[model samples]
Target: MSGSSKVKDGVSGLEFKISQISKNPPSLLVTLKNNNPSLPFTILKWNTPLDPQATNLGLFKLVDEETGKEIPMDGLKVNRLIPPSKEDLVTVAPGTEEAHEIVMNKPWLPEKRPASYNVTVSGKFSGVWEKYGDDLQASDLEAYLDSPFSGKSFTSNEVSMRVE
Candidate 1:
């Protein structure tokens, strides 16, 4: 399944695609496109699926199609610093896109087979910089956090798949 979100909150698009769902472990491709014409779109890497452990399954939501019940996800809950470092952010150039791949394994899939599931991701595009000060001036983390994308929640288009 493949889907994309419309422009919202200065974000161009959030594209989601599942390749070979029938496979034991499907590949989930998520791309974030920058709408800014000049400035590069910078956001916390922990906000994306790329850092599932940090997000603690907060990035993706999976529901059983038949039962209409939400599938539970488990991940490591990371304790981060007040001001994130430069390496903790992802920068998408203006008019460009950044893509990340996630392998859907047992943690993301239902135990029972031959079932269908719908998946969607929802979270803030960036961290809440307003609550944080420029404590780490050397990292220049405050600059990236203090953006229009900060603290803006977005939900991606839902994609469905059948597992045999």
Candidate 2:
């Protein structure tokens, strides 16, 4: 969560949390009220990354597993980051064989809902720009999840999100 705490099997060990979810199905259903009024239809929730204390590349959305020609929510937003829990993640959330080499997750989204999920990694900018910038296409789910870019790596770089 903080810095790349430990390098394992050629990749950084990491975990991520749900930054925000853009829509709420029940609210977005457009209910007919007594006054015939519409109200807010979205909600946001927070999480303590599955693993509490694994340190890795701060937080970088490792190209989502769901692939397609979908556009990213916020390009100019630089990058979304999360705060490190300071607890040891290894014991809380054990590492896997496959993920031992790759540092990403595929969150299973609910069905029949129009929602956008933004995962806040543990770090700030610099890396997202240096890695996913230039090629705006890299921000694309499909492109970022494809070959080459999918295997992209950076030097021992670290960035912190200065919450102002």
Candidate 3:
């Protein structure tokens, strides 16, 4: 499935695209593209372009079509500490994109039998203004995001995939 997210009045944007990239061990290619003409999209380091968590949670989800249940992800760990550095942040320049490979396996499914599933992408769009100042404060940024026209969270269109 594919979809694009736009900020208030299209100040900036993000595009999500997914496709099957592997066959043996089924996998999905998740691509996130920056749609802003000049401003760069910032994301947490080691995470997908649309990951909203300050910590890395792996940016993907699978849902069973029959029972409408989410597949429980095992061995997922949450990082409690956040380091400050340029490397801690990933910038997607205008017209650029980042891709992630997600392997599809039975362990991630609610049931062992093969079935149809829907994929969804979700995350937050960090404010670009935060990058301008050296001494950034969360309180100040929070106030700005609290504005009436803020565009912070986004969810992509559901794309269907069948596994045997």
Candidate 4:
């Protein structure tokens, strides 16, 4: 499934897509495309679901279509005391896309398989740096934080899959 969202300011937009890579163990490939022609888009890697360390089970919502119940995710939640650093940011260059693969195993998925399931990516992109500290000051970083894409919540199109 694919979903796209245009920022309110029309300065940037993002296209998100999800495709099933495997069925037996259940894996998914997520792709993100930057629509801006001149500027690169930045996303908080710690909050983005595309990163496995970002808590994939919590960021991606999974529901059983037959039972109409949301599947519970068992995972650890990490809380950082300090603000996000430059390393925590992912940049998608102008008119470019990036992809990542997620393997859903025991903790993310129950031992028993559901007949059918619907999955959607949902999360908020947020983080601000009051002090650049040792990090390099760039115009692109300032532009991204000032843009409408910052601190925005997004939900992708729901994709349904059948489990045998």
Candidate 1's residue-wise lDDT over 66-155, tens digit each? 989998776556677766676676656666777776666655566787777787776665652221232335445655566545666666
lDDT of 1 at 90: 62
TM-score winner, 2 or 4: 4
CA deviation > 4 Å runs, candidate 3: 5-11, 46-59, 72-77, 111-113, 125-151
lDDT of each: 0.59, 0.23, 0.54, 0.63
Cα lDDT for residue 124, model 1?
A: 64
- TM-score of each model, in listed order: 0.72, 0.17, 0.62, 0.73
Deviation in Å, model 3, residue 29 alpha carbon:
1.3
Q: How many residue pairs clash in each candidate?
A: 0, 5, 0, 0
Candidate 4 deviant stretches above 4 angstroms: 1-12, 74-76, 81-83, 127-148
Quote model 4's TM-score.
Answer: 0.73
> Which candidate wins on lDDT?
4
User: Sorted by TM-score, highest first, which candidate order results?
Assistant: 4, 1, 3, 2
Candidate 2's C-alpha runs over 4 A off are 1-4, 10-134, 138-140, 147-164
lDDT of 2 by residue, 73-133 (tens): 2222223233211121112112321111222222222342333332333321111111212
Which model is ahead, 2 or 4, in terms of lDDT?
Answer: 4
Candidates 1 and 2 compared: the better one by lDDT is 1
Summed over model 4, clashes come to: 0
Error of 1 at 48 (Å): 2.4
Kindly list the per-residue Cα lDDT of model 4 for residues 20-60, writing each as its tens digit.
78886677777877766776666656566665474443787
Q: Candidates sorted by lDDT, descending order?
A: 4, 1, 3, 2
